[model samples]
Target chain A: MISEEEVKHIAKLARLGLTDKEVGKFQKELSSILDYFEKLKKIDVSDVEPSSRSFAAENVLRRDEIKEEQSKRNRKLLELAPETKDGYLKVKPIIKFS
Target chain B: MEIKELTIKQAHDGLKKKEFSAAELCKSYLDRISKKNREIFSFLEISEDLAMNQAKEVDEMISSKKEMPLLAGIPCGIKDNMLVEGLKCTAASKILKNYTAPYDATVTKKLKAQNALILGKTNLDEFAMGASTEHSAFGPTKNPNDLSRVPGGSSGGSAAAVAADLSIFALGSDTGGSIRQPSSFCGTVGLKPTYGAVSPYGLIAFASSLDQIGPITKTVEDCKMVFDAIKGKDELDSTSVELSKIAQAKYDLRNVRIGVPKEYFVKGIDPEVEKIIKSAIKKYEDNGVKIEEVSLPHTEYALPCYYIIAPSEASANLARYDGIKYGMSNAGSPASKLLDVYLSTREEGFGPEVRRRIMLGTYALSSGYYDAYYLKAQKVRTRVIDDFNKVFKKVDALFTPVSPILPFKIGEKIEDPLSMYLVDIYTVSVNLAGLPALSMPCGKAGKLPVGLQIIGKRFEEDKILEIGKLYEHF
Candidate 1:
């Protein structure tokens, strides 16, 4: 079973603030789930190469020319932001002045 | 004629013949949505005005004596995860509760270009994560067949919408059986096209590598029509591929070979569902089609492997909802740091199942555990792929039951996430291997429907659809 600290660490990495009840619940759930995933350890994958994609995908390239329609789309996207000023999305301060 | 029971072909023919106007057909569906949507919860938002205006355009075209596309007058549902350009695309999550799509998804664009009337956006599990729509932040979509049971999901709303005749058809994305499993429960025809067969541009990303958008319809023929309209390469999506370059072999029933994977028929499957699937295979054999028992030994590991890989990708995809750009944000308070904004927004915004998956994925991809979990699952994924590769060489298509059980009760397995994940055991391997598969109603396990899954090789949608068509007639 995974420890509660590990679950806490994972939540921190995922940037999620969990209530104490949720932390306890996830601790039990994630432990059981990880135990189920332990079965994969028995398989012999020494000779096999890991594959992330189901099919081969070649890189697709295109010209980087900007279009008038894209700027219109940008304006629409900016409108969705909760806080915007001068056509820029506003967010909480990133730097701390201690 | 009962407008509710009209298939795509019937609707198209009726429109061309002027038996009824597109506006009339559109209103009939809107009327049905008004009457039934409250109980089933199939649609999250109804685009009544947009649908009416599109119907008017089709009516105008008919009057002008212009040729019409097959989907020209068809009113359909877009799964809420795909963007529809100005429509609400919530992905059935609180995070995107007020989020309106600013662009059209490639499939939506394709459907719009064909003049297919958009009825509204259907519901799904938050970020298409759960096997049932119970994870939907709004509410669960009840099965039309049995009000107490769940319509399988995260494509539950799309399947239920089609099954309840709320929409002529609907589009759904499959990542680990999201489309086919729900179609099985709702008794609608659904296809999960080969990876890259349809463009994923504008689809709310789930597991990027495993994600595929396909159709849910009343019949295989309608599924084919929708697939044809939305499929093919797009410049916006790099993974999208043109299927025309690959030559398809015409299948003859008498000479075709069908394999029943032995692993899928084992314990845990409801006996009635098994019996129905076996009988469906018997009908194929009765038709002079060769039936053989095949073994895909890696089948048992598919669900576990999928749990790892899908979550790993989902973690990365979901990281974008950090309260800065569009979506529900919790950053308005004084002295709120950027990190605190991410934490509080996500904590308040995402549903439980979505949070569980994101956490699971984050842990799996994190340092020290990455090679043990994610890498190992990917290698097993290769074995799953190889199993399909070896079996397809011996058979034209493989047949299995879409799910082990019937449409389960709404709250039965929601608390037990593992059991919910187990629901996709028989369907996830196809996604892992990037193969085309379809779920068609084979027979009934009592009043509940059983679906026969027909899986084909990569880019072999034509072959499987033909096989499904053959069984559909029988």
Candidate 2:
């Protein structure tokens, strides 16, 4: 079973601030789910190669030229941001001024 | 006109004959949505203005005596996870509640090119995580056939909308049975096209490797029309490929070989659902089609394998929702630090199931657990793919029940996440192998509909559609 500390650690890793109640709920739920997932260990995969995708695909490259319409679309996207200034998205202060 | 009984083809014919103007048809659907949508909650946002404007364009084209596409003026719904420029695309999550789409999804662009009327966006699970739409932050979409039961999900609203005739056709995305399972429960025809068949650009990322956008319609022919319109290579999505590049073979319906995996018909399935599926296959045999019992031994491991691979991919894909770019943000609250902003915004934005999945994914991909869980799951996935490859050598397609049970009650399995995951047992293997599969209503178990799943080889949508058409006539 997953412990309370482990639950809190996972929530932090996922960048979700869970309440005390949610922590307890996830502790039980995650433990039960992980127990269910233990079924995978029974399969012998020693000789198998891991597959990340169902189909094999090659990398596709395109020209690096910029299009005028894309810049206009980028402006519209910036407008969706909560805070923006001078055609750029504004965010919380990263460096402290102490 | 009875709007509920109209199919896409019928609507096209009616428009061509001037039996009804495109605006008239669009208004009919908008009126129906306004009246019935409140009860089922299938639509999250109704785009009445957009629908009317598109319909007017179709009318202008017709009056000008210009040739029109089959989808011209046919009103449809897009699953909320896909973007429709300038429309509210919340993805049924509070995080995106106020988020308006900045651009059109590739599928939306294709449909717009054909002049298909955009009725609105439908609801889905938050971030397309859960099997039932009950996890939708907006509210659950009840089954049209039986309001007390669930219309299966993450595509629940799309399937329910089509089943309720709120829209003639709708687009849905499938990741580990999101499309096919819900289509089974709702009694609508749904197709999960081969992965990379349709471009994924503009779709809200869930599990990038497994996610596929498909069509949910009232009939197989309508499903095919929508598939043809939205499929092909796109520069925006590198994985996208042209269907013509794949070789195609012609097969007479009578000479086709179909395999029924013995693993799917085992004990946990409802006896009534099994009986219905078996009878449907018997009908094909009666028509001189060859039916064989095949073994896909790794079928049982698919769900466990999917749980790992999908969540691992989802963890990386969803990491972009860090409260900086767009959507909801808590930038300068009690704590003005960037980390604090991410924590507070996500805590308030995500729903319970979404949080649970995000945590599960993060844990699986974290240090010390990667090789054991994620790597092991991917290896099992290779076995699952190998099983399909070996079986396809002997059969043209495979037939199975879409779900083990019928449309379950609304609150039946929501409390138990494991039980909810079991609902996808019969459908996830197809997605794991990146194959095309169709879900069509075969018969009924009591009042609930049972769907027969026709699964085809990778890029063999034509074969499955042909097989689905044969069953439609029977």
Candidate 3:
């Protein structure tokens, strides 16, 4: 079973601010879920390789030259930012800059 | 004849023969949605302007001598997760409630190119998390089959829209049985095409590996038509697979080999649902097709494996919703409240189920636990795929129940997440294996509907369509 401290750590990692009640709820529920997942330990999966995707695919690349159409799309995407300046996304810094 | 109830093929033919104009077709659905949507809560928003304008274009194409494109003028309800430019693509969460898509999704672009009339964006479980639409911040979408019951979710709104005749057909994304279970409850035909079969270019990532978009229609034929119209490799989604140029052998019931996994009819299944599904299997036997027992031995582990993997990927995928991007941002000071922006924004934006998943995912993918949880699930996932590959070698298709139970009441499983998660037991394996599966109404148990699931091998959608069409009564 996972502890409340672990749940708090996970909440921080996930960038979620949880109330004391919600954290308590998650501590109980997540532990039960984790306990349920304990069943996987019985399976001997040593020889098996993990499957990340359903089907095989290769990275697709196109000519590296810039196209006018792409610039138009970039402008549109920039508009989705909560704050932007000079066609660039603007966000507060994690560290102080001199 | 009810214009709102016409299948895609019927509507396509009717529009060609001038029996009704595209505007009339659009108006019929719009009119129905306006009248019935209040009670069902199927639609999050109705794009009347987009529908009318697109309908008028189709009408003009008809008025002139030009031939209508395939699926043109047939109104469809889109799950809100798909980006439809200028329409609010909320995925039924407050985070994106006010966020309008800047550009069209690949599927939306294709549908528009064909002149398909889109009714509006429909509700879903927030971020497509839960088995029932009750998880929606917008509120639950009631099953049209029984008003007191739920339209199985997270695609509940899409299924309900089709079942209630609010829209003729709809698009739904399935990540852990979102499309199929709801289709079962609502008595609509839903197909989760092979993973990578349909492009996921603009589908909001719930669990990227498990996610797929497919049709929820009134008939298997309509499902096939919608699938044909929307499927093709897109340059944007590298995971998307191209339809093979080599023609696949046409499948017919007389020569088909279907496998019935004994594991599907396990205990905990509603007895009435089991009886009805047995009858569906019997119909296939009554036909000339070959049926035999096949074992997907790892089936028992699929649900637990999915719970780990899906949330793990979702935790990573949904991290993009941090404030300072185009979504509902928590208003605060930039420097001190910067961390608060992400925390407060997500806290306010996400619902309980979404939070539960994110927390579970964060824990699973966290350091020290990744190998035990996420990595272990992936290995099990590989075995799940291997199981299907082995079964398909013996059978052309596999038949199973979409959900173990019938359309459950709205509040019945709401508080119990485990019970709600179990409703998808039979369907999650298909996603885990990346195979094509279709759910169609087999028979009724009491007043509720039962769904017969037809699963096919990787990218063999043609086979499932043939099998599903045989069972589609509507």
The DockQ scores of all candidates, in the order shown, are 0.83, 0.83, 0.74
The interface root-mean-square deviations, each candidate in sequence, come to 0.9, 0.9, 1.4
Which residue pairs show collisions in model 3?
none
- State which candidate has the highest lDDT: 1
Could you give me the TM-score of model 1 versus the true structure? 0.98
Candidate 3 has what TM-score? 0.97
As for candidate 1, its clashing pairs are none
Worst 10 residues of 2 chain A by lDDT: A88-97
TM-score of chain B of each: 0.99, 0.99, 0.98
Superior by DockQ: candidate 1 or candidate 3: 1
Which segments of candidate 1 are over 4 A away from where they belong? none
The parts of candidate 3 lying over 4 Å away from their true place are B250-252, B331-337
Tens digit per residue, CA lDDT, model 3, A1-98: 67889989999999998999998888788888888898898898989999987766578887788889878878887887778888777776678769
- The better candidate by lDDT, 1 or 3, is 1
Ranking by lDDT: 1, 2, 3
Write model 1 residue lDDT over B1-474, tens digit each, in one string.
458788999999999988999999999999999999999999999999889999999999999999899999899999999999889999999999999999999999999988899999998999999888999999999999999999999999999999999999999999999999999999999999999999999999999999999999999999999999999989899999888988877767679888999999899999999999999999989888999999999988888899999999999999999888989988775635788899999999999999999999999999999999999899999999999999989999999999999999989999999999989999989989999999999998777998999999889887888889987787
Tell me the docking grade of candidate 3: medium
Which digits, one per residue and each the tens of the lDDT, describe model 1 over residues A1-98? 77889988999999998999998999999988999998887788878988899977788999999999999999998988889999988876677789
